[model samples]
Target chain A: MLEKANDWSDTFYDKWKPIAMGFVNGAEKCLQCGKCTGQCPAAAVNPSYNPRKIIYDLVNGNIKRVLSSVELWQCFFCSGCFATCPVDINFPFFVFMLRLGAMSQGFGWEDVKQLEKYAEKDYLQDGITVSPEERNPYVIEERGDIADIRQKAGMPRQREVSDEAIAEINMISDLSGMTNFMKKIGGVELYDCSKCTPKIEEKCKSKELPKKVGNVKTHYRFYNYGVPIGGADNA
Target chain B: MHKLDKLSGIREEIVADIPIPEEIFYFQSCVASNKYPGIESCTLDVLNKLGVKPFVSEDQTCCGGFVTFANVAAPTASMPAVARNISLAEEEGLDICAVCNGCWTFLNEFGHFMNGNDEVKESVNMMLNMMGREYKGESNIFHIGAMLYKLKDRIAENVERPLEGLKFATHYGCHYLGGGKYGAIDDAQHPSFIQELVEIMGGENVDYTASGECCGTGFTQVINDKEKSLDHSQMKLESVRDEADPDFVIVLCPYCLSQLDRMQQQLDYRRDVKLDIPIIHITQLAGLALGLPKERLAFDAHIGGQDRFKKALNKIGIDY
Candidate 1:
């Protein structure tokens, strides 16, 4: 609802013309219906991501201002925006495009340094991901299935991403083009995550795997259909 | 494993002269082509028995999805190639379908860029124009999943040898749904097309609830390379095997099938789950139901089906 601004700085316009124009075109057609804003789970938790507002900023050639806002990064890409839009406009895809656009133009990734570490380094080691022993109440509450699977896998439990593995992922990340982009534009520290090999060798001591991880459920003993499926009680 | 779901296995009659198509185009998937040739043949055989002909465009490459999601390449790179391929189908007046979810999804990218993003279309067309190929952007690109759905009636009717007592779960890969703006049919989370097709074929579509989840077949190794013990790749098949409780798992995408079937060995070895769900492609199922020869059904390559299909063939009036 800020005052209409037809004008954009020459520097910002030239840098993000494609991105800024795409957003503006996308937003002006957004219908102001609040479908995307409404369905955004993040919006439910935090009101700052007015999909309407984000689109509004983009439509007006406000690339710098739009990218600078923290609200842009919070979108979950859940497609709630697409489901709710009457025009069937896919706002989440647009938001993703906008984010890529912002990153390409060098305005958005203020906190990309932590992310860059993963992109730059590699560590090859073999160890259980983390000992399950150090897990806290949060682990019990949030990832109970994973925790249970970790235990069942006969894995020593440590919920934290191991220090060694973290170092390795950074090794791998730095080898990619993504790291260079992050380094130049968004000022994100790019890591070399692809190179972490020693850690992988360390973890080569095989252990039981979780029965279910993400969507895949690995049944170890038998395929019984009559019994109640595992984890039916989860959210 | 072979459990029937319907009252009668008999198929409805249709005009014999729809003239099953040939010169068919198969969309090559980054994951499937890389991992499983077994599934690729099964899909082809299924198409063949339905009297349809197929041709693999070997010159065809990855559907540009590796860069699409990351948003690195301009739409021009993808759209023109797709538009040119689609134009070939239109020239043949044939439907172009890819078995892998990602390739099928990129087909939608071609559709959207041509109809929605004119500038992107122009750029793509310009490049293709350089290649002495023209892209008109009118052909329909389908995932084998959608084609199976479109051929549902034909499928039900062609059950010369029905998979009478088979219970299976469905795995609808992510790319198939969100392929592009105009690329999808049903809800991405809970698609019923495969399930319905199972029922039409006289096989029971079991309750494998996590049907829409990513099989972790694509990009899983790259992303999870750091944490070897993490078993992140296991998520693709493990979740469905545990929940669906089906005797066998079915997939339209070869990548999903490979992860489900090949990873079965991994899960059995690594997790000791002994999960042995044989993954079959929809086209294979259709071919079986249509009474294609057992060998014609491409049963040899697809894992976990020889014994089950033998039992099924014993009970049905099969032609092949």
Candidate 2:
């Protein structure tokens, strides 16, 4: 059963605001502009997947409502919104925050857990996410004889990932809270702006930088836009 | 509004500004390798033909962009993983080049992250300290598509089989065009580099609405909301179909190619619709124009069959 959110206290925002600000900036500045939805390919296909409404609900502290909704999962993260937003909101990253909030609470677990296979594959194989034809017959059928095709093209088989690198990545994952985060134990901290260099801090602390409030600081640190905030104490 | 123009022409000045590097560390895509190995091989073939020999390292791992960006894992793990990947490239003393947009965007964003944030860098270095690896953040990350665009004239001079008279709708994948650092390569919304390549290769560039639209292979959306995912691809295809009938849709990103290629079949099956437009990577198209064999180009691997492209090639007198 989905965990019902009867509590709409400031604590709700406290828990989510840091994580949300970790990826996206400018949720507070959304102009009620339908531009994100107008440009959204997902919105064009599915009327319910509205970026504007998502932003609207988010700022209003409807975290659980937004996180639990099917519309939240419908974002393609094509970043059409990021491209169009006058405020330069990374709507995809905003959607990502909602995903993390959802993941933390065990919502949409079954839908997204399948990606764990690829994550594990990437770790075990050193860096390769999808398994090769021998292990995945569907891959062969879907891609139509990839290994044989490569040989015919005079290309060597895909290079092997080093065991040392694989082991290192495994250790990093273990240490970085990836293993726990995957299992929904959820202690992975994606980004921390306070850790930024002076140069990056200047870059992140732009005019659009939202004012810091109660241990939650906004760092707009995405591709030349957005910032990050360490959410939890450990984060 | 940052106008998202799909049919914008090439910015010649911007193309001129690109510092064409002699050597680069090739960052391979795990999905492209497994799903469409040909995209990787043909990309290399095009690069070599253009006189850029990229170095490949066994130590380089997946960019882990998809997993992290998809929220499958936190950036704590993925950021260090990418930093490690960049470190391997730096050790080789070469700039980083990726054929897929996702890898390039992830590496580029994470590069900025590490470079801008000393504390994150220190924490990541602490983890790497255990592995005997350290990230100094010395390399510049690029998508090979930009290189192809930058070297358009040189590539044109080298073409053996020009694809004359075919109209191509170029899907410049979202990450390549919309992502931060890469947006500077061309007009983010109104990019024309791919169309420029198409024109230089003797093909007509189809100017369509939604040409700048994504193929709808939303990273997690594909896993979580597949119907919505297919709808996204279907919307792009329908927009293309409505506006113009291009011979092929050129994409540089692996995920876009996968979604555009595979989802077309699903859209057809699910809706009984027939929008049979073949999608090819810019590298494959360039490989074909350079007279590489169809086998090397891996045209057979696409769900949208290469029949029209093959026939078009035959008409142009290139037999392989």
Candidate 3:
């Protein structure tokens, strides 16, 4: 069901190198520490996700393996993994990169497909799945039930951002190469997080995926603390 | 941790485990009396535990907050009306505790307004003068959430039972975690203060992603609209069910409790996804683990009932 190794003939090339640098910069808080691996609840349970190992992979230039690996999705992104890092490294953010990378290179569709379920239904009206960004802001402003209560208490009704605003926001997200890459790799529809299950594989497969968000290129940091290249793309 | 230390008082009661106020003023909310009485009962239960002795007074109406927060009535009318209520509390010489965030915010901000806006303050204090009541500009008013957090150490210290491994996530709601003007005991972004209370009592703090989102039960906003009303409530429920699925969800506000507990089940089928997460007042969960029976504790009144919290109660017993 999952793809194995793809052919890599220095496929990364010079084109993506500059864009990938932005990920390194955005990940400026990252310290080459293995602490995230030590503390991650998912990593604790699943030996497959060693954050340090992914960090090592990024440095190894193993973008292919990072592109296809399911390891990135396991992060809980509690920020605890980043909070405790001595160098202040945030591997969870790197996890966000792999999510895009997986979708970008048409890798890890299974997990990307799964994660997309959260945003699918509300994607049309509310925009985006997961209520926030692709990476972990770790900010949850409303839960389903509490939102239910606010209506009863007369919480001020907010109009869904106007179509103009939604389009502008998506235009901005498209500008972020990583976000566009995510849509492609996961085969996610341009605007939805639902229809992510394996049964909805048709919706999960998009041929004209926008791998590049706006002008910037989207890249995956498959090796979190370890390497992102260990999955199918690099195998 | 000094801010954390400001909280952490000892638990002096058993059954209600309600915080007992040596001097408390029952600063009521507009909705609680006619709408949600459980908030009153639950607050009383918590007050009783903390050894609080609340004094209820006469002629208390809306904290003038309902319309004020809603933007219907201007601060011109709201401020003076609130100061009158504070004067009543001051006459009793008690720290005011409103079960509603609106009451707490209005009371806290009324003094803030009195000091900040001289004309408004003078007018309010002037109104108090006519009634033979001086609005004591510096009266302490707090929500039940802040009071509970303050008693964390006390909660940790006394536990007839502690709920271990019982996953819980807290919904702070807006008034508690507003734009930061009202001030909350916990971090608005990653609030674990209440979760700490659950853990201290030996309960599991469920590591859910949507712990801090709005519960969209704005009493006035969705009165007429059907779709927005459902979206408002459904979104909050969807977020909590997003991850770290738990035995139960805890809330500090009554309106939040109603939406999550009562309305959620009704709307569950309409939702794209189904959640078994039961919502309860934070204090209610505390009372359950403290060895209170279903009657005094009143978990059966909830839709999913004690079964959601029953295991946690048993776990707390084993841990203690």
> Which model scores highest in lDDT?
2
Best by DockQ: 2
Q: What would the per-residue lDDT of candidate 3 be over residues A1-235, giving only the tens digit for each residue?
A: 0122133434432234343323223233456666666644444434566777666655556665665554654544334454456675545435544544454455444433333333223332243211312121111222223223323433222213346423432332343232333344344333333524454333332323333333333332232334222221111
For every model in order, what is the number of clashing pairs?
76, 8, 94
* Model 3, position A92: C-alpha lDDT score: 44
lDDT of each residue in A37-140, candidate 2, tens digit only: 88777666665457888788778776656765656666777777787778888777777766666654544444455566667655545468766644434435
TM for every model, in the order presented, reads 0.58, 0.83, 0.51
Cα misplacement distance, residue B36 of candidate 2 (Å): 1.8
Candidate 3 residue spans exceeding 4 A from truth: A1-235, B1-21, B30-36, B269-273, B300-320
Instruction: Give the candidate order by descending lDDT.
Output: 2, 3, 1
A1-235 per-residue lDDT for model 1 (tens digits) = 1112223463433344454324323345667777567645445433444677766656666566565454555454434466557777667556656655554444333323323322222111211111223223432443343333433333223223345333322332243233344344333233233543565434321223232322222222211112212221220
- The CA lDDT at B312 in model 3 is 54
**Runs in model 2 with CA error above 4 Å?**
A1-22, A134-144, A183-235, B1-17
- Stretches off by above 4 angstroms in model 1 are A1-92, A102-235, B1-23, B90-93, B178-190, B214-239, B258-274, B291-320
What's the lDDT for residue B298 in model 2? 76
- Cα displacement (angstroms), candidate 2, residue A140, comes to 5.1
Ten residues in a row with the worst lDDT in model 3 chain B? B8-17
Model 2 has an lDDT value of 0.71
Docking class of 3: incorrect
